[model samples]
Target chain A: MAALGREKMKQLEAQYKKILADYIVNQTEKNLYIAQNFTRQLIQKNISPEDVISIHKNAIAEIFPDRMNEAQPAYDFLIEVMVHYGMAHREHQSLLQKQAEYEMEMKIATSIQKALLKTHIPKLSTVDIGMLSVPARKMNGDYVHFFYHRDDYLSVAVTDVVGKGVPAALCMSMVKYGLETLEYAYKEPSYVLEVINRVIEKGVDDSMFVSMFYGCLDTQRNMFSYASAGHEPALHYNAKQDQFVALEAKGLLLGVLPNTKYTYQEVILEDNDIITMMTDGVTEFRGNDHLNSRQIITSVIRDNKYLSAQQLCQLLYREIEKIHGFDLSDDFTVVILKK
Target chain B: MASKSSVEIITEWDIVAARQLGRNEAKALGFGTVDQARITTAISELARNIYLYANIGRIEIERVDTETEKKIVVTATDQGPGIHDIRKVMEEGYSTSGGVGAGLPGVKRLMDSLEVQSVIGEGTTIRAEKWLR
Candidate 1:
């Protein structure tokens, strides 16, 4: 049995030598074929080339049992395969690393853009606000922010950038900057929106627009002045009437056209009156009975007018949760100001 | 100068206990002033999140070494509901659990550095550092 095994080893060595001789004639082609075959075989058999090489090397080591003298060719072949495998593995790992780096950069950029757009609410004497937002997706173009430049007046605005994901986020950032710039450029609500519209129109592509509701609250005077650029209606919950009322201003959305004019409306908000402002994320929600978002919100407010702004927001969220069974289609934000 | 001046506590998955632990630690670390109330608030927020989200968790408190620029490091770990969307979690007002969506964001605001690691169905670890000096 030992004699026959030696003969078999000699024959296998001869076959290996013949294959090496054939490979030596075209080294590049042979190497290319080896790589391709390795990949194909790995995919086909769900096995790793390294594992195959390891098993082969271990078998040779057991049979010949000598590092320097016996099984040297097998050892050399294993080394070559390992080197080739390492290079291929390194390339594959590097490709994955590059993709991860690209994704990381995208997230950082998106976060920076979000930071620019989602400015925290500025404290003002005119109002006590309870605001909450829950994005239904990774990036929502919905924006809610406040600016208090003057001591007696504070400006609150909510805008929905006209898309979703990263592009919408970028547009929202542009609108935020435009609003900040408009604060310096103009003061009246209508004119401020006009300047913002021009700024965004110059900055954004033709496809983009912003639906906005902007208002200035005068606490001492108990008056509220606001303008709308084709945004969703603002809900005015009269503490006296104990009902929710929608306030609409007639105007085109910002960036829809160059030099579009906006209209301003004025109202008196006395003690304990509530003004609820929101994006379409609240009004456009679909419910279990397939009721549109507007009906759902109106019904919720009608049923629960005694709840605080924060409480109302929570109730609305819970109702939506029940309606969609825990799926939200857009970013939801609601700001309730109690006077 | 005292290495063991600060006390540490580990408790079961009770959100109330975690909040108490956070407040106690923040006070022990010398942030008891009313102006710095947010520091304790942030700590409580993080601890509450961990307790509510995980079945088991741990909290460690160490005195801010004045020699090391007076930085306090607070870490919260949990083995439940690994944040599959960390980026979203970090975003302001984004919460899967019923909250103002302010836990992570508020903690980030209070601390100088915030690092989080989470795996789906595995676990989550949050590290927050607040500068005392």
Candidate 2:
């Protein structure tokens, strides 16, 4: 739309006509500068290019009556050019408006997604926790949900949806609500995983699938129970023996089958023992060429074993980011619980 | 059965040929009978898409063995007018309006992982991988 109203446009048009007539007489640099200023004013008024050409023709006809026949055809050709230019200018403005609308929607979506899987890390006197999830794009495919109701136990799950962007984000919301409906600590990790699996299979698309590692920590008993649905192997650091071992279980990725059974496993959490879980986006960060991403991730944890749980997660993420040149190919997530 | 095979798709017979190659590749890669069925169905869907849209393309079947996993990877490539909106087409209930076709999402369902790369005027290449569990 034109920046100026009808009266202002008419006043500017008269001013431009005077400026053009003066520039025609002298052709001085100062006159050229004045003409440039008129062009800017006309643009600010939202005067189309063709409208400028029309005003030029009127100025010429009023200034030189006998010279009209010679310049009329030339002005007509320029009017045709300006007509084409006007269409292109409007198209560009329309495209910019659409871009702004799309970006605004994406920003709103990002905030909604953040609220969908709100992970509140609990502060327990027995176990310290650290976690982080960074989406490569505006929408996140990887999510970490924490459930801590009783002072005696904490239940958590690290899940990754195979599909990316919006679809994956939506799928994760279904998982969060499903997990919430169940009573915590009383239900085994396997049951929680199976319920989420059934929920995803029924609600999501056939093409969509999810991988998850569900774990529950019993602080008073010093026990850790867990299950996996084709997710990445969680690493365990045995403080007493000073060793690292991968915690793995056999099960299909969720949403692939209606009643896929997941295997449940448990380990006693000795003093200062730590359990680290993550999605493929974290373990497969180095990609195909690097065969030992699991080893590298484990070593990072062992080397930085003394740091706080949260600090360990941040350091591991930074280390992976630095090695991968800061451009993560997928949604990255990490969660660690130290007892 | 070859570890890798490429089938040039031009006629309906080519779709059958690719399916045969997919079964053989699946068996050779140590996939069970149920997995073989899944692999062939995925192959059929991808081949049909190439035939319907790509007209003439190539379907490559390969057995990939990595340190951590073994998988059957199928790739369909063509130099044709590519897909305009890949994300829209991949969504559920999105079928090409013209006629009957299995669509790309079906291929994704039958396989373990699917990756599609399409340039509007350049070409399209789709790769589907099914890991042996």
Candidate 3:
């Protein structure tokens, strides 16, 4: 019995040594590679090395789920390495947990932000809306849209929140809510903006404001009513004349002051009239030279008047991408209303 | 309105994915040539926020048809610390970071219609609608 026991112990020892040696010599290097990458990310984020190790462990578990059950040994070894690297394991875990939490929150916020967009534009009978937008990073400041009530009566607006991250997103939500709440009270372009401005001032602080364009389209009347709040001008394309004109209306940005009144300007639409409303993302898009986004937008509209709204938007984006070579520096958005 | 139409993804504040998702949703709506780009832009901005602030979130896209209309509604939900003052958050230039603060408010200003509900420390829900006509 004793001989058998001794032999059994020897076999177990051999197996353990083999696995340990393989891990130390081969697996350890791979783990170190992953660790190094994770460390880079943490350092870039200004997180401590201990926190880096924790994120590394958590990330490893996720990427290699098959080995999650066996992660305890790996984690122990990581803890030892962290100590050698002059990091406190306990503090690192706490920081890692916090960082993980922050990352989770940002993910949740992005999901929420995506939800704010439309999966499909509502099909309308008389008016068609074509829109395109590219956000810079996860959350951007540019916003644009088309609101069609019926027939030729359409409302469109584009806004840029003053920032890029969470605060801007929150402010954007407020603007959305304010518009929904105040829309019924003010249907005219200027009135709607006036009410929105007041609501925003009441809700917002001095640091935040919205630069936007609000418009009401009368398809039956073949006219439009528009208001601007320190936003970019709407471009009007005349297919007959083969020309593009900018409709500029100057007003204070939303949330800047209470009871700020906005003025509306009128534009008549002819057959095959193309109207484009865009955010600053387009105007500010950097090309090899200073690519006037407005000029490119107008040209695209003139070139692709036959395409449908969605196609036109895509074509414009492709062109912009082509002009810049690749990638946009800002949140590029466009709203095209065809008559 | 159905569950199958929705999907969730995770990223580190990736603006490109947000834009792609917006275009994908528009494509799903069969808005191939029409002007759904503006609505997509609005959605992109809102989703970007979820990545920038919450760091983690869930996005839902559904083909919703009411008695009178058929459109797509996307909702981005977040469970971060939550906005302490939603009103303040909506103001442009009122950013905690140095960036221009045009994310959610800008989205609202873009969509056909928008709805927002938030509770501090709980989470936030943003709903935006786009018309197909």
Candidate 4:
């Protein structure tokens, strides 16, 4: 078997000598295509890459009898490097394939995440409402929903799941269905959180948890009733007192405990008063993982008191833009109600 | 960054919304591509984290034990004005004024047992342990 392999190798070397002579002569712009095509056949003959160097030297010597020392060790070294070049080229080709595949996946994920989280902000004449939600990264873990329970009440829920990506999105879809099922119960903030907690606890993985702030605005009564489940506090800007109030509530995080109950609180909105609901992504300036002073959100609202609700949302986002820039570290969300 | 003319990547993605937030930054910086703006954003974020957490909080990792099991525990401590009566918000039956509960109950269930101890003006220590079956 070994002798037969050697004879075949010798025969291939002779064949390569003839092929290399042809390959070099055909290395012109006009004959480049034919040269490459002929070389492909020579390569397909199972000649070892190292053997090509020796074969090339012999071929060069045979083609140019007087050009003796032209095929030296330098030529041998360069041809050996060509072996590496071919391997590297193949590796590069596969990498480009993987990159294209990844980019395609990212585009798909980005769009799906967008469609899942998309919702319309209602425009009301009596009250101007503005909202902004931005992901710190490509995937958003924050969830917001606005439900109009009746002609007089609009309920907004701001939720932030503990994790990110598809899992968090899956949790969000569950919460969405949970909220939708209790459309009639949107009037009460505590009950809304309670139902969401039950749904999350039952439907979501035990390892996951989410913080939520549910607020219902009674437009006719000018009352803002809200509840929270391990979420950030909503700020109340009293246009009268010229100060900000934190509407704080406490309850177990959704998916944390089954049969957990939440606390409800209500505040009457004086004319020109503002209620800002948000997730820790806004954190009223506390930041998602930091303990920033609550002054940041209030100061923006106070300084831009005359701006429309939409502008307020934009300005708050801009301010967060200052903290986070375009690549947010966490999903920053905010909803503003101006009366 | 306003993405006036977006790259032909994702179809029907928010065009106006995708406005060159990068170009916006690039425009602010005078000139550059979105990639350069991203590089700047990354460095700036690192600088921001250094500024924010320079002297703020710490994580204490230790081996802990409960009545039923042995486990490892992590306690994160932050030195700042604790936000609005957070201790009361953690009380079992007490309802938070308007903020979310401190998430103590969920912590309790995830761990085999959980213990919380705090001192007004001093600190709050939350300890929880998981039973390794």
Provide the overall lDDT of each model, using Cα atoms, as 2-decimal numbers.
Answer: 0.67, 0.81, 0.67, 0.64
Question: Tens digits of per-residue lDDT for model 3 on A1-339?
Answer: 111243443453343344444555678776666545644644454443333344455545545679878885777456434432322332344457778888999999888877784323656676667887778778766665555665646777778887777777778877776676754543488887887788778888789988889887787887877899988898888878888889999899888879788899998888788888888767676545566666777777887899987788788878876776677777777788777
CA-based DockQ, model 2: 0.01
For each candidate, what TM-score against the reference?
0.52, 0.66, 0.54, 0.56
Residue clash pairs of candidate 1: none
Name the docking class for model 1: incorrect
**Best of the candidates, TM-score:** 2
Put down candidate 2 lDDT per residue, A8-47, tens digits, no spaces. 7567667877898888778999999988887887776667
For model 1, residues B85-130, the per-residue Cα lDDT tens digits are 7887775435334432235755665456789888878778888776
User: Per TM-score, what order, best first?
Assistant: 2, 4, 3, 1
Q: DockQ score of candidate 4?
A: 0.01
Give the Å shift of residue A104 in candidate 1. 1.6
Per-residue alpha-carbon lDDT of candidate 3 for residues B1-133, written as tens digits (9 for 90 to 100): 3222443436744445555666666666655222244455566666667776776677676665555666767787877667766676665434334222235544554456777778877777888876665
- For lDDT, the strongest prediction is 2
- Please give the lDDT score at residue A10 for candidate 2: 61
Query: Candidate 2 versus the native: TM-score?
Result: 0.66
